[model samples]
Target: MSTSMAENATKKLTLKSGDDELFEVEETVALQSQTIKHMIDEQWLGDVIPLPNVTGKILSKVIEYCRRHAGAGAGSGDASTSKSEDELVLATTTSGDDLKAFDADFVKVDRCTLFDLILAAHYLNIRTLMDLTFQTAADMMKKLTVEEVRTMFNIENDFTKEEEEKIQQEHPSAFK
Candidate 1:
């Protein structure tokens, strides 16, 4: 093979989403994702693989998550250091509390963007993103009334006022 061709093969992979948006990521980093892993395993297509389900905006976020977690599996850094994650968990209330606070704060976003993140996370096979987004959704629901959920998700109220009353009468805790 030509030296120039070998150099090209060693270059970072470029991923294109369904919307024709692109992401250039190291092959090592891309392999951290199971979706990419499968494609690589099967020797599918070329260096520039396309993901129809993922959009550019969401794909970028997924890449960020994969990069953080790529080293995690290799026993690489803070995440895989000598101490178990739980070792410090019980020691410092403030440490754990700080992380919890960080998690909460990091998840602040509108419903639609949050959903888009979820979809991208799922497609990218990034567990942390999926878990965080799900937890964020649950937290949002916990803070809202039933009507608030309906309004937030833009769900139509199917029952008429009379039907609603009848159902409410049958199930006293319906709204709650």
Candidate 2:
């Protein structure tokens, strides 16, 4: 691609969050969101893309994830394709391991923030981000007992004592 054409292709997009904060992101990075890509393909280039369901904080995080994944050569090809041993090592260090570490840290947020991220990722049609956030939530639940899960999520237990006992009796392994 010519320099001018590449520059034009890399043009930045403005994303407006629910709080009315505007984020400038590269077209390639923003294209990671299927929703945004579809809107762009449909010729919706009128100023900023409004994300009415995403708060500024969660939107920022989502953009960060998109930017990282886009820049890391994700979906390009397998890292082992036509590369020397040293090149493969370097590629794994820079992309694979770093992205994994970033993902781990990214999900280390409060419950409210995590849920907001999940919702934003879903709304944006970012499958990878949605999966990461959902897996994090599932991991949290997996480590908690039923009572603990209810307490953490502020869920009211409507089951009567008799019903609860019956359930426990039927599923003794689950109660433990």
Candidate 3:
């Protein structure tokens, strides 16, 4: 087989999540994460790459996202990959409506799980995943009042009544 053929072949990497769960994924899928790619490059990685910051559930979701994306771009060999997450997300959202739909459904988890996926994606340096999760969070909070947003995130109301009133007065539209 040719070198390109060999490179395209399904190579597997084992990942060990923080909760001790193990996953075997294609190298193409795992390489979607710069963190995992760097781990593979910077060390004589053993059989398993350990992700100490991510739990199994989050890791599983990350892998699913990576697998879907890698499969989407397979064989196309498009060299116009974006450098920044903001640009990449914008570019991707315009180009692939199917992927956009997938991303919309993918982020429909409960708040805690969505936040966990965001942290895991950030840690993994998967910019697309990070952007998707962040956008989902922003979408969830966009139409909500400050109090409703606080309640959604379980954040305490730290400001005094007078301070709150001052803020409401200053930004009446935000309060409404």
Model 2: residues with Cα > 4 Å off, grouped in runs: 1-4, 74-93
Strongest candidate by TM-score = 2
Best by lDDT: 2
The number of clashing residue pairs in each candidate reads 0, 0, 0
Residue 47 shift from truth in candidate 1, angstroms = 2.0
Candidate 1 deviates by what RMSD? 7.7
**Lowest-sum lDDT 10-residue window in model 1:** 82-91
For candidate 2, the lDDT comes to 0.82
Q: For residues 25-120, what per-residue lDDT tens digits would candidate 1 score against the true structure? A: 756567767788798799887868898998887788677655544433434354333222332232233344554565566567678878998887
Off by over 4 Å in 3: 1-4, 78-95
In angstroms, give how far residue 69 of model 1 lies from its true place: 1.9
Clashes in model 1: which pairs?
none
Q: Tens digits of per-residue lDDT for model 2 on 1-176? A: 45655465457889999999999987767888999999999999589999899999889999888867765653356422333333344445566878899999999999999999999999999999989999999988888899999899899999999999999999987765
Q: CA lDDT of 124 in candidate 3? A: 95
